[model samples]
Target: MNRPTLLVSALWLALAATAHAETAADASADANAEANELERIQVTATRSERAIGDVPNTVDVIDRERMETLLVRDLKDLFRYEPGISVGSSFGRFGLGDIRVRGLGGNRVRIQTDGIPVSDAFSIGSFSNANRNFVDLDTLKRVEVVRGPTSSLYGSDALGGVVSFITKDPSDYLEEGKDAYFGFKIGYDSSWDGLFGGATAAFGGERWSGLVAVSHRQGQETENQGEVGGTGSARTQPNPQDLDGRSVLAKLVLETSENQRFKLTVEGNEDDTDTDMLTSRGRQALTGAINDSVIARDHQSRARVSFGHEMDAIDAGFADRLDWQVYRQDSQTTQYTREIRSGLAPPTLRDMREREFDFDQRAYGLQANFGKDFSTGSAQHALSYGLDVSRTETRQKRDGLRTFLVTGATTPVMSPDVFPVRDFPISKTTTAALYVQDEISFADGAFRLIPAVRVDRYELKPQADNIFTEDNPGVALSDISETSVSPKLGAVWHFNEDWSLFGGYSRGFRSPPYNDVNIGFTNAAFGYTAIANPDLKPETSDGLEAGLRFSSAAAYASLSAYYNRYDDFIESMRFIGFNDDGLMVYQSQNIAEAKIYGLEWKAGLELGALSDKWNGWSLRGAAAWSRGEGRGPEEVEVSPGVVEERQVTRNLDTVDPLTATLGIAYDRENWGAELAGRFVGRKDRVSDSSLYQQAGYGVLDLYAHWAFAPGATVNMGVFNLADRKYSEAGDVPLVNGTSTLLDRYTSPGRNFAVSLSVNW
Candidate 1:
């Protein structure tokens, strides 16, 4: 485990309660659950507690009540339901996850924790959390996913959209007359022989309230066994990660008066990973793939502090919020020697360390909103305005070494042997940004308009001397500075209380990484080449979104469509011949243009009667389609020495064709049950140098619960019931190399877990 792992020992206790079976739970507890189903659904799309229906944009919300019984642990488990969204894991661990929104990648899909941006800044996988193996999935309230281009509120990365991880706020769900809430849970997984346990406590009063949670888990190996139940799966990705993780979240709320109060909170994330992979020497025998075993260790830590205040006025209010944070991350990789039957080469050892590498971000921003409702020229207007600013600095190190492996099992299922190699020069970076927004509602809220803009100035400083020297130069010396402007416009017309129509236009972008701009190093940064293009430009998008929503107290439904125009897309181009260090490296270059378009539809309704017995049962469903393509592009590099401005390859506008979900849920005072199924179609997505056209797939999940004792009960279910075979993944295509040797599993197979919980 890395050094940061110990810090997690002190944290909030949020357990992913699990049970293998799908059946009715305890009785009176079910009665207690009935009240929860009827409560209001509050979302932070506009930084306020407003009914989801009131928001004009398309927002996917998974409530806390569902979060509890469903046992959704990581990003993948939580987001697979939305067609407009796709998720991936890093090293097959829960500590890390990648998200793609509206066919846009992670960096463009701004991720926030409690409305604050919280991802790795190294620009490697475009996420700071990359080195940390598993992301802690504990007591979370709900995840709010804004589908489509969201350049208005969030800045750069909001090009694709935004996903805010909102953890449970202690005072909202506590029992009446009780000072606090306490819960404990224990569970297990079949894939990795993994075991996990956690606990949580929350306290509240008329004026003050707070919550804290903690959780931990240990695992040996997890099976990959591709697409189970089809032919034969018992597959494996890498067992290199001997993993342990912990997280803590704390918050305080103070009520100053009836009209206002204050809120302060803190969050921490840490992971300790010791990875040692297990693979087949000659797996397929047909394709003659090569497999290799290995070991590695890494660590990560992130901390954040936030404060918010609100004051009431005559039918209006003034709200102010401030958020700040500091984060540090490190990664190291080592190769060991081969033992017996691995007569491919004599066992060798190499050391690779990424030191002097620190991801630091010092950001303190303020957002002040002055909102009011007044009659003006026979119309009522609710106007709000605010400002936002933040700065981030990131650095990378090549202090890592490589070595061969020994004492580990040979590559699995008859795979090829191993060969040793080395590369030089690591990459590093830093950035800063500032912005503002204004929203307006006219004619008694019949029509609402919002316009916002953000200006960002980035400084890309690359320390070439650290990895490369003036004598053995690849990158030599290069530093870059650039500025960007993003704007948003939207309007919603409430035809009536039960219906509304909305249209939105937004622009978003991302600056090229320092490594991608000035690294003369070989590929191998994250096992892929670290290409640099000094002239690389920022990626930009301009999109138009239109939608309609028909909602009532008992039913809700929505339909929306979007079209995106992209400019100067940043792509990691294909690699060329061996460099001075005899290593292959791909180039990070910018493209002219790309286009994306999509549609989404969703509906919900109450069912099973509204009276006694089956009173709270409801049915819900949603569907979406998206496509991405390179437009008016140029340049083609043929083998040898031929370069021509070719139109491009794989510019098909048919990626992520369709995604849909159907669910049945029972919400009661104490007893509840839910069953949801999903189907996603094939994707034909592409970029500058490659395209990934994959077959679509589907899965079904079952969850149900009942209350037996006063404070104890059981919840159970199955995920991917049909044992579906599918990949919600995309990557730059590979060459003639045996993937079995260097590749990692991208998706999880049919798996199940069970747990019991006690709360009083």
Candidate 2:
């Protein structure tokens, strides 16, 4: 990073503060009274408490109460009822259940928790799991989904949209003046023959308050439902896989004064998965049996501490306010795969890919913002300046073995000696960023504007070559430095009680995966073996969006559109060897251009003519459409001459076309019933020339809950009711036949689950 260049950018931004002295805000609804303005408490789309109808963008809010009744176990489960969102073909079984917002799908979007960026270090996560899984829905207060890129406000990877889950505060755990409370729950599922339990407690007194929660769940997979003459079923093996997991979460706060406070949060999460999977596709023989292995054994722990003095004076100047936070994390996971096939050439097949990893990351950040009431100035404005520095270091050691089909040639063509072995030196990356944001309001309250800028410097280093064993030498590597300056500009107008408009544009970019930063490969089975090329560049994008809002306490609607233009995109090219282990490997390359465009819509309604007892019933929905194309060197014409003729696909075709959901719920007295359905669009998502596409499908899920008492409740739900037939998105064409298919996973049939809870 060039220090002089960065300083110049910061100076220019600082001067703009004096020129554009307009009051800025996230949204007006956040500052309003939640109890009085039930219409404005939206967590998604925008930050402030603006009604969905009054904002120009698309946002879908899943209130905390709804989650209690739904009994969701994973993040994908949360999208089943949200508008303009759909579960991708991966079926949410793994994190691969890509989420499509406003036509943009997969990792193009961003995921956050309580305002902090979530991890996406894996091979470009769209709907795939990460170092740690998403937080449980039960622990969340509300979910906010903004349907387009706002990378200017944030930095890096904010392409399609951003989804943030906000957790509840200490106040939510207390009962009036009570100092402590407790709750317990247990659940059972038929599909997985699962068992679940949870407990929570809260305490508050004098200047301190805290809440603690713990939970566990165990599950067994359902038996196969398909009847390929029970030939392909391979029922002779283990019919059910098992999983066990536990988690602990806590939040503590100390209040020193009315305007000063301190808060701390800690969480430990871990899960063990024993899964039985099959390699049955369209052309593969049913003779190949299903595989069994300990799919995942993951554990993670994290802690965050922050202190703030709301309104304080610093030395001789009125410093407005100050806040500082520090964070740390430790996590590990070991994944293994084994074949339990029946009639293959090699009756017994076993392959194990093991990774023992340890990483530590820390952040030190500070923020100071001045309050603006206009009483002392002609224009009311608040300005915030902050500095953030982070450092993360990780060590990785992976061991793997893949089994191949042995023809009548008994020589064992690809033996272990020359087969595949992967080991990479420990890699580390560090970053330092500085930023400033300001908001100004004019004409007392009619107009609001926000302008912000951030500058970041990153350093990447790879350990020097060393001997791992007596005769083996580690590979040599290089270090890299990256710098970027991002900016945003936005404005909003309150035309009247029923009309308003908003427009904004943000720039975002993503550094390539750390693993790909330095390494290349020659012999790799499931992972890149070793072909280190430290010259790859980061992908950048400039995105813009416009929206409209209209609202009433009882009803509201929103419509929005956005476009993201990308540059120097990192892509994968087919420059490789044969797949001795069934899976294909590609040499990653860089592309010059690509663009994604989308539209989003969402609305809500509260009934007025119905009985007062049913006044809580509401109707809400959202839908989105997106399309993208490649325009650089990667887009050159090609011919495969087979089942596939010619088509267009940008990098991974995981992008879904259109996803939508419409549902109505009745929150009557103590009983609630919700009928929700989710849809997934089809796409030829393969990065290969064949461009195999999966047809789109939808599934209906029904849930009901009853509050038996102040501290007790029951929830029952049916998943995939009506036994829909579908697969999560992975698919490819047959060897010689055009219409024939291969290797696609089908979602499970209808299943029921019930849970009971008690609290005090």
Candidate 3:
């Protein structure tokens, strides 16, 4: 069917299925029940416990049931059917990618697990961890996403949005009256030729509880269905990743009193990947470098330990609750490569070359929050205040060794390396922040207003590790400091029990990262040298959002719009022949101003509410459209020894295409199934660059779940049901502003997966 026809048919099916399922009175009762259940779902969107529906913001929650039903294998799987968020995996690699929200990504968004942040942001060459893949999906019970600037409460790194993963606790597994429980799960994915298995055990007593979980996975490389250039071509995208991963989680909880508790959690995860990097199609197409053999072994791991305490009753005046947590985390990624090349006429390397690189970030943090409830005349108020402090130390190292031999020479000699690979130095950053927020309800709960503010201080100290440059000159890395203040205001008007209108305005900020500020590099091959930029300013954003929401026994829907403005955007500028050094100079500077706006709509219907005969049937859909434009730095040589830097206004390359997802589902006690379609609109407004323009496409998927007996279930999914070869919008490889190989980064072809799980 056509796009419009398909959408109309979907609506008709939803109404018809529900119309014959139940009577009006039955539907009303069902609506009430659903509303009640929704009210019980609590969230931390405002830094305090509140019902999901009561929060004056746009948020998405993926609970454990949904996670298990979908048989999620990675973080990207969680957002496959949701709008406003897109997950993109790096080309030629298995796991490294990014999660973009509302045209912003990378360091603009913040990721957290149980209120503890992960690693710092740093990307070099083809290797990156921008997706926050360090967390173990097996141990997670839920994932929450809040879109838009939240720096008023989260301090920083929340310019685009926030993603929080809630892990499984002992209380989640134990029965109402039972004190202990254990379970295991096994899954397989044909696309990656993967196998995964996990087990969990938990127990709780009168005053103490504990839980432990372990999971492991092994997978071969992922396959692509398209040729190198998307047409009849002999070359195709290379697939050479072989991966193994393991994760462990342990927690302990003690109830000091009826109104107090203490908890400790320790979690660790590791991933090892073996791949042929230099021989990949993208690499070969980039520089015409043919490879005899190129092998890369990369490892990534993360470990975190956190201690927390909570009390409902505190002695502080008017304070009804107190919460505190202290945590220490270590995240690291290391890569070792061995390659040999000889096919080229002038070979870069005819023998073996071995290289090692390491990037590590260690963090320690402390957070405390207190909540109070009171009344002021005709308004009831809930106030929350908190203090946060954190210190992070980042270190990087690299060493390259090569062995070469002439065609007639028998012995290969180790040669001295001339060019340096990694130029970033060890850096330490300390951040301290204080924040406060208050939720006030007036007009007898008909109107609610939330006001919040946060102030932060950041100190950056480089280790003076870049004392000697590639030119054998001594240079000093300066220390930098910055301060930022963010504020937010939101209000919700409840016209009646079934409908509400809400809006919010907030400010966000992002400090310059160590890699960007203290970058030191000299590429002789490219005739360029990059020095540190200690005068960079922090980026800031101001956003306004408004939305309307309505819910009934049989259906629920929301419509929202937002506009955001950013200033002092950091961008890299390259200037040639502007100085006496006689080499091109590159530096990061605050050089841009931008504005972005978008509209979003989501709706869901329950067929069971229409008639008893159509019980367990439902329909749901979501759509988002966003566009942004900003001024970026560009350098042009006006005359000899004279170059001018200009700020050009253009569409941002990070903005994703308009996207939507529609699904029909049937869920019951014994069996469940769903059919979904994802659609993308063409992206042409971006700059006339090969990397930004993308075409529109659509794909279908099917999923099913069956419960054979108590606690025994089987889930299966068929993705890309029609085997259509289409690429996701904005998913492309960046080959350093060169190379025209854009079609090598498409999504995987048709794939199937099945999972068997049991709980007791």
| Candidate 3 Cα lDDT to native | 0.77
lDDT of 3 by residue, 1-760 (tens): 1433444444445434434433344554644443222343545578877765677778888788788877788866788877778776766554555777888887788888998877755666543342367888889998888898889988778988888888999889877899999889999998789999999999999999999999999998776674653211233564567889999999999988889999999999999998866334222564454556667888889999999999988777858999899999999988787766555555534555667767788999999998998999999999999999999998876666666534533222233234344456678999999999999999988899999999999999987543235422444476789999999999988887767889999999998888778776655555667777889888999999998776666766677789999999887544434336666777777878999888777767776666677677777788887888988777768899997887678887677777889888887678989999998878766665644456688999899999999989999999999887766653664332344455466677899999998988
List candidate 2 segments past 4 Å from native.
1-59, 83-110, 123-134, 222-239, 277-319, 338-378, 400-424, 465-476, 520-534, 572-588, 609-616, 632-652, 679-698, 728-744
Candidate 2: Cα lDDT at 603: 55
Best by lDDT: 3
TM-score of 1: 0.76
What is the Å distance of residue 483 in model 1 from its true position?
Answer: 3.5
Query: For every model in order, what is the number of clashing pairs?
Result: 80, 39, 8
Mind sharing the TM-score for model 2? 0.77
Each candidate structure's TM-score, on Cα atoms with residue i matched to residue i, is 0.76, 0.77, 0.90
> In order, what is each prediction's RMSD in angstroms?
10.3, 9.8, 4.3
Q: In candidate 1, how many Å is residue 534 off?
A: 5.9
Best by TM-score: 3
